[model samples]
Target: MSSISMRKTTLAAAGLAVAGTLVLTGCKDGNEEVPAAPAAPSSAASAPADGYATPPAGGASSAAPGASAGGYDGASGAPAAGGGAVATSGQSFKIGQAATIPFTSGSKSGQLALTVTSIEAGNPADLASLNVADKVKGQTPFYIHYTAKNTGTTDLSFASVGHIKGLLDGGAESGVLLIAGKFDKCPNESLPSGFTTGKTQASCAVALAPTGAKVTGAEYWGDPYNNLNKPAQKGLTWK
Candidate 1:
């Protein structure tokens, strides 16, 4: 099968497993990169409080279109074993537990707060609901849901949905399934359109894993400052 067809099949399986049905929605087509503040010519302006140079306004993610449902190129199957958690200051959370990470500085500058409300293992029955052009074997779906709000007085760009990642035990990274407006089982209030000050929307992403994959936990990196090799923010442990 073709790569796009394979991705759509995997997405269909994941969507049904998580949402009770398939409702694909969101800005996967647009090349609109995450926004960053303009650079300054003077030496004093050269440095931003965050230390890293802002991504250019039109800069696209390194991943190509349909590269993988959630920007990964690897296919769904068993991954290499023996992975550990990424080191991070993120607090531990339980399923349905809510955690907030407030933006203290940078382009966001107190204007944004990311709230992760829940995490859960997906239902296998939902997988049966899918009508696939092809079948992806041994994979199951997991979900991470959250809300991003703009607390500032002015309108700022809100695109935190694409940045989050998921992993299984042994540090196997899951493929992110982009959800548009139709997340049936995993209802997120915000998505497609983003947040303005006092505006909040719920959104969720489905991560595909092999059946019987031991998913002991999940992680979220709201800030890019997190170490790529470890969990840099918050996580959940299934009790």
Candidate 2:
């Protein structure tokens, strides 16, 4: 299998973004860009598919301590609870729970109240609408839907805010498929105009598990948490 580098951008000075690219194997050639979909609110559109595969090579470490195996059964389609306490790194939260953590985008820095509202299972057939590789099409699909609220000062307009991944049973991370364009099933977008304090945004990431396994949880692998070289470093997880 050939190795390919997937650029994962982070904030940089002068409107430039920079971050180390992750080397992944077994990826098909050509970029997969879906046409932008109509804007919509973030919510679980459907139940996810099953199956398990090892995370991309050199991915983040295993789930942090206290991570568990389960699914969130919270009220469907409801916004996350409000005015909750901020959560620290390495802490675990459940579905529908909020975690206010440090956030950075472009040259701006602040805190965002992030909530993993649901992990909806998606049909592999959905891949037909995308230009993904065949292997990716055969794998199960999952939508990691979330909501983010800017809890700190600073307008994060046009700054990106998403570093979430699917967590399978036994602490293994799922293969995160990044589509360049909009995917209606799991649409993602950056902080809109004037995303200053008290502003909130909704987005989603696509997670693919090998046929027959399911995504049991989700994790926030922002900043130091995504340092693949530091295998000991852990990220916040939710089950």
Candidate 3:
């Protein structure tokens, strides 16, 4: 080869070497990070054939429209083992030995038609009747334990059914003192129905001569009067 050609070839080789060295230097300096590839989205079609998809982000919770808000995915079936919905039976109650105090027959006019399917006393001192009646039943303040779908239906008020007659002793029925109106007397504090964690309509009691001497026997009316008898306050009333 001619000297000039040789010299040109030498320069070309040096230039290539310089370019390679610069690239090597860049790598060694760590000036640039290797770019990460974009991730592919999850495939809905690839979901498990089983009715359930993997539980939501938080264990078994996934929000499905019109379904239980959380912890419950609208899927069908009984509640999951531990981390799902829990069903509750209706509130059932039994009446203790009940006493019916008679309302003056001529005084009030109506068919006292409240029905009592079952009655049992959860506790002796405090009586609880199931499905008693309203004024139409001629029974006031009788407690009927009930269970219902959580329809958000409840009332908060005070009621007064005038002149209830209860038989304190086995003797004849006489007028029992009425307080806020529904409850005959403040229930025994020890009773479950005595107080609730989330309510204000405390049970009523007559200003009896002796403490806890509430009306007991009248064979016609240990009625469970309700607070629904009064003019509703704040538009919230219970039945």
Residue 156 lDDT in candidate 2? 77
The 10 consecutive residues of candidate 3 with the worst lDDT sum are 50-59
User: How well is each residue in 1-239 modelled by candidate 3, as lDDT tens digits?
Assistant: 99999999999999999899655533211111121123233221111111101110111112231233211122222342222332111111122221111111223311111122222222223212212112112223323221111111222111111221223333323222221112222321111221222232212222111233333322121111111232110110011
- Candidate 1: misplaced stretches above 4 Å? 1-110, 124-135, 156-160, 187-194, 221-223, 226-239
TM-score against truth, every candidate = 0.44, 0.66, 0.19
Best by lDDT: 2
Where model 2 places Cα greater than 4 Å from the true spot, the runs are: 1-86, 227-232
**What's the number of clashes in each of the models?**
14, 6, 30
Candidate 2 Cα lDDT to native = 0.61
Candidate 1 global TM-score: 0.44
Please list all clashing residue pairs in model 2, or write none if there are none.
Answer: 47-121, 48-121, 48-122, 50-213, 51-212, 51-213
Task: Indicate whether candidate 1 or candidate 2 has the larger TM-score.
Answer: 2
TM-score ranking, high to low: 2, 1, 3
